[model samples]
Target: MLSWKPFALSVAVLLILFPFVYLVLLSLSSEWRFPDLLPSYFGLKNWATILGSEAGLLESFVSSLLISLSVAIVSTTSGFLISRAVFYHPKKNTLTLLAYFPYILAPVVFAACLSFFFLKMGLFGNITGVIVAQFIIAFPYALLFFSSFWNKKIKSYEDLVATLGGNRWQTFIKVLFPLAKGLILICFFQTFLISWFEYGLTSIIGIGKVQTLTIKVFLFIKEANYYYGALSCCLLIFPPVVLLYLNKRYVFKKLV
Candidate 1:
């Protein structure tokens, strides 16, 4: 018999998707408020305006993209190298844990503490400041993903590589890394998504001048600009959706 569990699971999925459907419909709808069960009309006009306006809206989009990409590359690369160090040398864990544990703190609280230091250093409200701030949030995620393989798999592999005349870097490049490459990509994407959608830390550190989509969406909602608010929310969701789709398309195959 076909299980009831599958049917129950499918309904649950639909319920979760209903809000996204409502948002998409809201973006398309001519007008919708609490009284309405459904939108009065539907059209592409809102999307067209938001995407084609070129009125600093797109600049914000570009800003978010670049910042997320920067966070991803730097955090992932650093985490990968750091994980390699942690893997090959047991002595480094003491100092590494001391440094890395701070990343596990909530971003808002962490950024608040660091913001004071940045203010003293004259670094607040700057793009460089935001990028560097996001690195702290991104690094731990990358470390968690990359470090997993090392805990159980690397020692034997390293010994094997060494016996075969492969040094640490060579073994990393030729052996350990090739195996870990998929995990690294997943880590990069995960970190980029966090940096992309992150609001609390970005807002605290950027101080409203360095606007990301999440910040902008909050601002729009506060002003009661429901159309632009919904529009902004959808746009805020776009990058991660694209990132996930691209990963599923191009990267999932390699991992599987």
Candidate 2:
């Protein structure tokens, strides 16, 4: 028998890493003429320039992080409540199915459909508006993701807590949270990535006022600044990578 696991893993690694390698190479190259496999020269000057600037990469990176974090926390927390509500309802199946409608739709189309309301509310072009728009995309998926945890076994645990005189707060704090903790963390990170990489809704709702890292990457590309675009990509990859490492080392281990 032939073992293909190692070969598959190697291929997967290459597929994932090749783009990052190309981006790094492009970012570092001062000049590379045609037909060259590698750049003529490489330097950290681009990164230094991006970091030292007052109102460019650094500001955009911070703005992106703030908005993404806010969207993640708000979407996950609210979606949890919404999922619970639907879970206990008589029409749970129907409602749960309906919850996925937004998630399935293209984000640009969804945002465009709601553009008028945003304009009327004076939310268009505002950071709050961008957050709200992203939440619209993120919350539905979180709700659906969380709905899986509200199964019969979990319900029995809830019932047990209630039978023991645990009120709503006590029930959630002691029983519900403990069982749902891992799933909640997963939902948070999923929605975090959703908001972190979201550009369509943000561009539509924020009207280009809110310049996130995704937007910065596009803008840099538009200006033919591959180095800055790669820099933004690197910055965008940082938080999620760090979170994934921390989650693996701590949160997932704790869950196990």
TM-score for each candidate, following the candidate numbering: 0.85, 0.91
lDDT of 2 by residue, 59-90 (tens): 88888888989999999999987899898889
lDDT of 2 at 234: 82
TM-score of 2: 0.91
Residue pairs clashing, model 2: none
lDDT of 1: 0.81
Q: What TM-score would you give candidate 1 relative to the actual structure?
A: 0.85
lDDT by residue (tens digit), candidate 1, 1-256? 7789989999999998887777777778766777989767678877777567543466678889889999999999998888767655757667567656776788999999899887887779988889999988888777766756776556788888899898878987898778887888888899889899899999998999888888878887887767666777788886778888989988898777
Give the residue spans of candidate 2 off by over 4 A. Answer: 1-12
Question: Alpha carbon lDDT of residue 124, candidate 1?
Answer: 95
Clash tally, candidates in order: 0, 0
lDDT of each: 0.81, 0.86
lDDT of 1 at 99: 56
